[model samples]
Target: MAVDNATVVYFSEQVVILISCGLSFLGSLLIICTYILWPDLRSTPRKLLVFLSVSDFLSASSYAYGVWMVFKSDSVDCVVQGAISTFANTCSFFWTVAIAIYLYIFLVKSNRRLADSWVLYFHVVSWGIPLGITIAAVALGRIGYDASEVSVGWCWVRIQATDHVLWILLTGKIWEFLAYLILPILYILIKKHIHRAHAALSEYRPILARNPQSQSPSSMADLKLTFIPIIFISLRIWSTIRFLLMLVNSPVRQNPVLVTLHGIGNTFQGAANCIMFVLFTQPIRSRLMTLLCFCCHPSRDTAGDGHAPSQRGQGAETPFLAEDTP
Candidate 1:
């Protein structure tokens, strides 16, 4: 009776996960489609949008097989959890690294480079490197793979008490720390130096009076534009920590509470980085709104009437009149 009840719960969780995944995927698709159909947006967050789409794709694809196993347990053959989890975690790690590196280069290098083939090369290396390491770890006889009644969601790999899963986990935890912590801090510190320089310039000019050295048009081109990447980096670090906690030694795995938290947290990370971050930006959001309004009302897009807003127009107005003798 207990076993049957557990299966039922697992099934319910799978349904919830699938629905969330589908919605998240739709959001990614919309962003990608906007880029495909529109030319203006191509200059904004283009590389970022690509990286995010790829990450969500791998993460979602890996989990789908695991979700399937919950419904048809026997259909899961060899360590599906191991394989899928491998892809998800790797993309989570490697791709996060790639983004950090890309951002840092964009900031310090002074020239943004975009080419059609760049995305293709990025996909190959980012996907290939971690995949090779994952396969090697299993094949080297260092880590064993098997399915256990411990969880239905894990189709490919689940580490038992004796499985030394914690050992493999600890190594990853260390590497993840290097990728998630040190690199972001370095980027922020470098950004601070640049910010300080710009703030100094604001002293000599009125346009920058309130805040001259806009973090935008510098390290970040727009405050609204930059917010998404900042959020992505923050979430990447957060998810890395949660992943470490979910490893073999975690007693939380046995808790219904931990299991649900793990599933929800993972899903949330995947969805936010792909959807909310991409769509909430100034350019992307503008394009998305235009697309939606055009599809529905068709005649209702007045977002870019080609006039700057009143406040900006006022800011541009000069206070210098034909002055009395200085």
Candidate 2:
């Protein structure tokens, strides 16, 4: 007996989505926990990352719930999952763009304090717009059981709605597309500004010798920041392509490989962020390693390392926002 195409697609989509969402949830949760546990890490940039992780956590958990609800075929649960996932996922996109904008202001504009002032506005836009769109989508009854013909093992805008395309764009796709456009442009500008700043600093190197505290931005930090847009676009482009194919009613949209890729790409964002910002960040990783060492060896003198874990609340340097430190 041979397995049919539909069976293959269904199984692949379900498994991939479930696993990806699980990883996303875990990754997002870890970021959130790290933020809460270490007050010193709560710099402006890290706060923005925490907000993004919050949205990712909700989106991933809701997607996993949507997968479970698929089995029950419960219409109400499907709608709820669709609404929550849409709201949270859109917020994630907004927060990602917020991070990019914050970086641009901090790096290019060179107004660090003023850049920090935008945190309130960032919260309002990132959370408020998504909430409004989700409410409108639910009011119009546009979100429900997105059949296997469209979604991977989750609920989203119903395929049956007359305005489903509009709802899809409003709920998530528009913001995602905007993030794709905005993140790279902003990061590129920041990179160019950093390079220019470095060139200018080189010119003043001898004069700056009198001021030992004067320092230029970290090129390594710029390199790490550059990865933000790359990872986001890489993990999200598949879903965008799938959506375009679906819009054209292309048969390739239903291909198991494409569907699996779409599911994994759509759900892997949180994990990608974890890998980029948390594990790859020197400050956070070093702190985490210290904590782990302390936990594993209770008798060891943590203070002997010259950085006591208790001092984490004293606003230590995070340098995650492309500051002087690398």
Task: Give all candidates' CA lDDT scores.
Answer: 0.47, 0.75
lDDT for 307 in candidate 2 is 62
When summed lDDT is taken over every stretch of 10 residues in candidate 1, the lowest stretch is: 317-326
lDDT of 2 by residue, 242-288 (tens): 78886887778778888887777878889988877788765567777
Task: Compose the digit string of candidate 1's lDDT tens values, residues 1-326.
Answer: 12232323355666776665666566556656655664443432354555556666565655555655553232334444455566556655656556555544444443346323355565776677657756765564333232322333644333433544553453244445666565556456545544655555331243333344632443222342244346545544433444455443354444544455444444445566544445444344555566666678856656544322312322112110001000
Return the TM-score for each candidate structure: 0.64, 0.86
**What value does the lDDT take at residue 248 in candidate 2?**
84
Query: Which candidate wins on TM-score?
Result: 2
The clash tally of candidate 2 reads 0
